[model samples]
Target: MLMVMDEPKPNHWVFFSVAQNSPDFTLTIVFFILPHSEVKMGLKQTIKSLDAFPRAEEHLLQKTQTGALVSVIGLVIMATLFFHELRYYLATYTVHQMSVDLKRGETLPIHINMTFPSLPCDVLSVDAIDMSGKHEVDLDTNIWKLRLNSNGHIIGTEYLSDLVEKEHADHKHDHDKEKDHPHIHGFDQAAEALVKKVKQAIAEGEGCRVYGVLDVQRVAGNFHISVHGLNIFVAQLIFDGSKHVNVSHMIHDLSFGPKYPGIHNPLDGTVRILHDTSGTFKYYIKIVPTEYRYISKDVLPTNQFSVTEYFSPMTNSERAWPAVYFLYDLSPITVTIKEERRSFLHFITRLCAVLGGTFAVTGMLDRWMFRFLEALTKPKRRKETECGSLSGDGCCFGGN
Candidate 1:
């Protein structure tokens, strides 16, 4: 050591230290890489095992005729049960819900296609009233009043609104000053024309076919067609000789919206006045809004209503106005029914589950049954062989 020892360079010292610890470095590398290599190998082995088909002994694969028949029957039963489960899964469905509409003043159309056998088209007038004190009387627009004969044959068809419009158009220039004044103008002329038409029809003694659509506010309202004239007060006060009008009706088609299959309207039928007394027939209708959604994504908004009827007969002093009244109220809640089918992916997953589960269960049952049968027969065969050997020994001893 006393001999001159030169100082070591930084790079040389670092290289020498690393070389001295080469064994630790090699161990650390092996520690990290070994586990990763083992994991990769294990993953490959697991995949290989999963991909490989199951293997069985030659004796296990062999089957007797009875076993084969039983296996076939079991498979048939399993298939039936699987299909039943599939059908049940498809049939069991859920409905999606939505919020109800609570807004007011929405209008709904009431379609009427009625035939009056005794009420003349002239005197039969349509009127509607709601809880809000709004009244619509003698509706003519969008209404067709067809005159019928005594035998219920169509005599003439008239659109009341059209006649009024035509008369107004004809006298448009002649009554410019009258049109400016609201006292006696277009509406008065229309009313005069309507009265004339009604008088003509009454003179002919014609039956009525009332068919039209009436748009009413979404509230409790009653619309009635009565024999009492538009000027009811004048008729009662001056013309006290007015006779009682019969109200025998045949409702052809009545609904809230366009006709669809399986839709039922309570009033679409033959309604006759059994008693000869003058009265009012009232239908209290409760309407429920419905939305029908098809699998093809077609959505139809419609309404369903239920009705209870009441008839009020006229008293001796009361005026007789034979009419049919529809009083309707709408519900706040709406029902949305959607049609759907099982998806392809869902069906495939269920099919696989059913097939795999059935096969596994049946296979286990079959194996257990085969083992039990073998165990039961083995003792019996062994006893029979023992008895036969004993008999052979007895014969040998006797011969000796």
Candidate 2:
């Protein structure tokens, strides 16, 4: 009527609908969570089953002497095979990767130790040039020149740069004296020093040893030592063109960086230049950058290079300077070697497979052998018993 029976309230209707769907919501939740729990339980059961030992009848499990011996031999063989496979796996597990080196114009230090048996220390010069047109002549910095006798024994050693600097200083002092003639107090000390140096060099022996580190651009370039001292007045006066300079050289240590044990440089210990004629020996080298990662987590960055050599003898028409030239080029690709060990889980799985497979196969083979032997002897036994019976004797079939 007028009251409209306090029309069913909105709250009541909402409550009624929720109550009606509550059972369905509970069932849906159970349906979602139940399978997950069941799956987890099933997984646990499977793992347990795999870990459990197999069961068999007592007689089947029993071992005879022959069977036991075969099993032991089979186990030994399986162990040997497993170890071999493991070693192979470990050896083959190498990871290879590459990376870009964006650092350009970097300098690479080339350490060189060389001996020239016939070249005098005073007459030798070091020169370097790159593809970029950068040239370095008489590179004395970080270099050493050792004076050696005809017997290839070191007699004296001096820093190449220091020697050059002293000479330059003497020349400068002489020029300064000329500028200040009034200050001149001695009988040309600079000239006297120069003469002394010349005499000392002349008196020195022929063999020369060069040991130094040259820093060059990472790009292709070459550094060489040559006997250009024929142009020097003092050097010319000392030799008087009497003896041909022997260019035979031994490379003691040539590498891209600090020396490491067991690393071999192809050019190291290389001896060439058996002839005395003026010529050029050129080496074309291709360098590959490598990164080695050991299992101990040590990382080493090194370079390996291959070389191709060429020799050109000087003719009367083109009497060029005798020199050794190294031409090198960098490879864009980098090589990485990493040592890895097998995972414990993987090793265990393989071990299980090997043992189980061997056991099954060997057992089958042993059973077949035993059965064959029994079959072969049974016919002979039967024949023997029949013969005894034919002879009218009381035949005994071994208490059968």
Candidate 3:
């Protein structure tokens, strides 16, 4: 099928039809293929049916070309959609990480004074336990009771009753946790006996430290410790064989880890240093909780594992969360996160392809049919006529 526009051949109009007239019924187009200098009398003008005109077959080819171009554009759009989907499937989720500030380092208010009953009385060991709420039917609501290690040398039940009263006397309070242990007597006296022993041992040149560092180690790893009362600290003084041992210099070399006390790792319980210190030796220590989560090694070691301490946010928390941030990336929920960025682009590309392809195919068909219908119904130029009139060029068919 084809559509054609031709330059009118001069002096050739095949002017036999009445449709070609001098006035009225103006056509949409005009063709003047022949020389205009021929001085013709009012050349082709009005439009009429092909039933009144005819033309050479060579002119139909132009319309077919138009249809093909439209088809190609549509095909390109559709193909782009398929390619976009392929790229998306191969896309990988990327995790962008930055050093974040984590809130850590909460100094526990509790402190213990150690005392031992037997050895030289110099090694004072103090232990306390409070476990009156356990063994109830509802473990969630039930308070896990603190208890004494009756099977061993330590007497936990007696210590709790005695220590609480004396410690709280500064605030004029009682051990409300020990309401069940009403039989305990002279809580203040017991506390006094222990404190007096600790003072005596300190005067006699003995070791005085916070007890239960082991309990903490069993749950959280060794972290940094910040001593609030630096002025009243009892740290080991290194001897330079001089008049004074400057312990303050040694404290300067130590660091404290996160405040949260890391997670419970039976084998992971230990402390270490992450930074370089000025001193050759570090006085490492751990402070246990008043209550034990589980039985731990009887004594804690000064050195156990490699612990990195920092004053910043990622502290010696129960579990170092930063180490596991990658877990969030590959999780199932992350698919939605990934899709949020990726899926919409794919849908648009695919839709464009579909629409574009359909458009091209439609354009191709429309152009071809339009040309065929045009050829069958539209009027054609008559090769023979008055040879010079204003109305014989294919009824001046509208824009070929």
Candidate 4:
């Protein structure tokens, strides 16, 4: 059998077949119709007149002068609001939040740079003690001392280890490890040499600058620069009297943690001067941990602090020492500052609201003004028609 099919039409098909063995004995025709009417009707019916936003035909729209003016003003208002929102969306802002501090068993890094104008390097020692009974005595490993002349110029630089080794090499035979090294406070023959060196430097009007990092446990602690680490006899011999030992100093930089942008450390460039009397200088500080989050999702850990200072005059007691002390305590709260920008969706919604509200308000105002003008003219039109019907064009209704 040979079968032939005609070109398909919408929703219908036609097929014809001939009997090849009988040389065209019979011819058959068949029709197939596809059920697509409902689908087409459904698609066409999806576009309905129940629209949230509707528009009038161009021929039906009547443009009035008042309506045009209202539209122009509304456009201006929308443009102004849109520009304002755009600026707000493009600008970056910082959000600050506070929470309880949860950090534990961490060490705090302190960077200190100070200069003593009237104190010699041999008589100045750095020591730290905390409320936890942890004493960091004679902190010298990471510290550097710069010898300055009377004119505040650097003369020489010395490391703590090198200075100690030099002193020990000169007085090796006189070294007594047991009695001399008692708690790092008892000075032996080597200490006597250090005192002599200090006396000579004092005669030449010398000064000292100390700068280094001190890593201590995170707790309330006090670190100071004084002659407290020296033996009583050695300290007494360095100067004429303990009362004359001046503790005047200048702080270059003092911070609790690594520096980041916008971090202000109050202790930088601080100067303290003492007169003829010796005194103790103390700084009571409160440290708050801070974390800064950048827009790129990078985080920086740092610290900020506030300080209160006090000074106490020293008496003639041998136990009294002149020093510059920094006492600090950590706050239990942490602050987080994050950089953020407005979301795109939020900006879009705000823009749409501004446009829609202005348009609707202006349209209502135009309609009300048009109706008021129409009401005012309606009575005049009625009087003119009545006069024209009663008396012809020559009739005068009023003085005119």
Measured by lDDT, the strongest candidate is 4
Badly placed stretches (over 4 Å) of model 2 are 1-66, 85-93, 117-123, 132-141, 144-209, 229-243, 258-269, 273-278, 289-299, 332-342, 349-361, 368-400
In model 2, the worst 10-residue window by lDDT is: 165-174
**Positional deviation of residue 59's Cα in model 4 after best superposition, in angstroms:** 28
Candidate 1 versus the native: TM-score?
A: 0.52
Task: List model 4 lDDT by residue over 1-400, tens digit each.
Answer: 4666556777743333434345755555455545477656756677654566778899998888888888899889989989998998887788999999999978888898999989877777777666665434443347788999999999998874322212212221122442566476666779878888988888888999999877777899877777665556676678656677899999999998888767889989999888888888999999999999988899988889999999998776534567788999999999999989999998899888888898889889999988987899899999878888867555655533
Distance (Å) between predicted and true CA of 10, model 1? 56
Whole-model alpha-carbon lDDT for candidate 2: 0.65
How do the candidates rank by lDDT, highest first? 4, 2, 1, 3
Residue 249's lDDT in candidate 1: 80
Show how many residue pairs clash in every candidate, following the order shown: 0, 0, 44, 0
TM-score for each of the candidates: 0.52, 0.59, 0.19, 0.58
lDDT of 1 by residue, 182-300 (tens): 36433456566765665555556568898988777677666667653344432332223233545768788778766444567877885664445566677888887877776667887
lDDT of each: 0.64, 0.65, 0.30, 0.78
Write candidate 2's Cα lDDT for 220-329 as tens digits.
76666765532333333444432334456888987876543345679987888575465667888887777777788888877777889898765555424456777888
- Where does model 3 exceed 4 Å of error? 1-65, 92-400
Candidate number that wins on lDDT, 2 or 3: 2
Per-residue lDDT for 186 in model 3? 36
Kindly give the stretch of ten consecutive residues in candidate 4 with the minimal lDDT sum: 165-174
- Model 4: residue 125 alpha-carbon error in angstroms: 1.0
Q: Is candidate 1 or candidate 3 better by lDDT?
A: 1
Candidate 3, 1-400: lDDT as tens digits = 2337454465654222223345866434443343443335243332324236466488664655546665565567656766766666455443222232232332322222222211112221222111221221211111011221212133222222111111211211123423644554433565556546544543444321223321221222221112111111121111111112111111111112222222231223222223321111122234222211112223211111222222222322211111100000001111101111357766676666666667766776777777786786554433323333534553434322
Error of 3 at 317 (Å): 27
